[model samples]
Target: MRLTSLFFFFISIVVFPQKTIKTSFVKKTKLKAESIVSVTKSSNYTSLKYIDNQTLFLKLNDSIIYNYSNVQLGDITSFDAFSPLKIKLFYRDFNTVVVLDNRLAETDKVDFNVVKPYKNVSHVSTGFGNKLWVFNQDSQQLELYNYKTNQVSAKSLPIQSNLIDLKSSYSSCWLLTESYLYKYDSYGSLIYKIKNENYTTIALDYHDNILLKSANNLFYLTDYNQTIAPIEIPKLLIKQFLVTRGSLYIYDNEFLHEYQLIKD
Candidate 1:
């Protein structure tokens, strides 16, 4: 009987986690755009890809706002505003990374196509210590690139799967491929690898918790653990989702709904 009970306990934890997500019914605001390409939130700003993918609009502290558009660079693949002072805008089609200031002014640009020892960069994210996390699709590696010195300081072994999404903090980075989710330290060392079940998006919450989305469904995966719990919420058309400071911001076609995620 003791062994049977222990087995059942283990099964309960692995198969029937009781964690849930409550919306908390927060405020909802309409975006100031007809179409939104993407959405991301930072400590003090909310960014939206507006007016055809070329324009980026950012609202700061709920009052100050700024806008930037680059017609020559074409559409922006993504942007990183973790540090409002040093923003990164990636134009994958042009193989360029545009650095912007807090006021959305262009400060610098890195064209991988013309850089010596050319790199076919597919993704770029802010890294610690004046660096950028670059994913080379051709080489299939994550490189810690020193943008100032124009050198790769560290890199991981070639990844076998194609990268779907990537999110990084000050000292760590997470890479999501079609088959696995990989975590690595700042030195480009693989910390762990776990199988993925078709998660299309990954974001860090206010507490730096991992949030994932797959096919209109949201889930949470704990750090360095295999447990994944569903984040339950009221059904809505999810065009994009952003998690910031314990708040879940869901964007539909016109409205941006804000909800506090209450963990039960």
Candidate 2:
């Protein structure tokens, strides 16, 4: 009995020793940026937009201007500029989705109060193919709405669970429920479901990749169709991430970190 207890104690010490990683948290002031474009100048920083590579859209005194491109897109609200072109913006104030043109013109406006089949809309995502993925609170169903043609398509999802989070990129969507991540195509068809080991935060990266962050670890999921392989991020907890200007910008509470993706 004494030998068994000693052996167990030794095993526990070897197995569960405290593992520590040395990390230095520093506030990065100067970025390793090839080009720096200033988006906002004024103190309040009310309205700002970045479209494509060269254009910086700004709205001041009810006039919108494309700063770098030297073109005026005209008057649009801050929320209207949220979606921009090839994207959809879900305005929380009016419960409306505003669609814009290449020149930031109003293409279409989708009022959730009028068009939604269910009374409550829980979440909204903007996708390619001019579609809006809506999670309805009443039926607990996720549906795709074509604002361009004004058509609605339903998706098949599991029962009782609500859509906790949603993201869209290219022609795909990432829907997070209670325990799983459901990938849906542009037409709102369920393509695959990834069962997460723990509760995770999901975001859509450039080139249709998915960034899954569980606690402090960030995993880059390259191809979901093939075998899912997750590459761990070394030291930082990715608080937020965005794919902008063909680069992934990860925020870690203090500063923005950039990563260049290697295309195969």
**What's the lDDT for all of these models?**
0.80, 0.55
Residue runs of model 2 more than 4 Å from their true location after superposition = 1-84, 102-106, 116-119, 224-234, 244-246, 261-264
TM-score of 2: 0.61
Residue 245 of model 1 has an lDDT of 69
Model 2, range 103-179, lDDT digits (tens) per residue? 55556777777863533655677755676777766667777767667667656553366556777665777878777
* Prediction 2 global C-alpha lDDT: 0.55
On residues 1-264, what C-alpha lDDT tens digit does candidate 1 reach at each position?
Answer: 999999998898878765766668678887655444345566666655444447766654465377888889987888777666788889999999998887789988999999888999998998876789999988999999988899887899999887899888888888999999988898899888878888988887643468889888888776745467788878898777777667787878788888888876
Task: Give the deviation of candidate 2 from the true structure as CA RMSD.
Answer: 10.6
As a whole number from 0 to 100, the lDDT of residue 150 in candidate 2 is 63
Best by TM-score: 1
Evaluated against the true structure, the overall lDDT of model 1 is 0.80
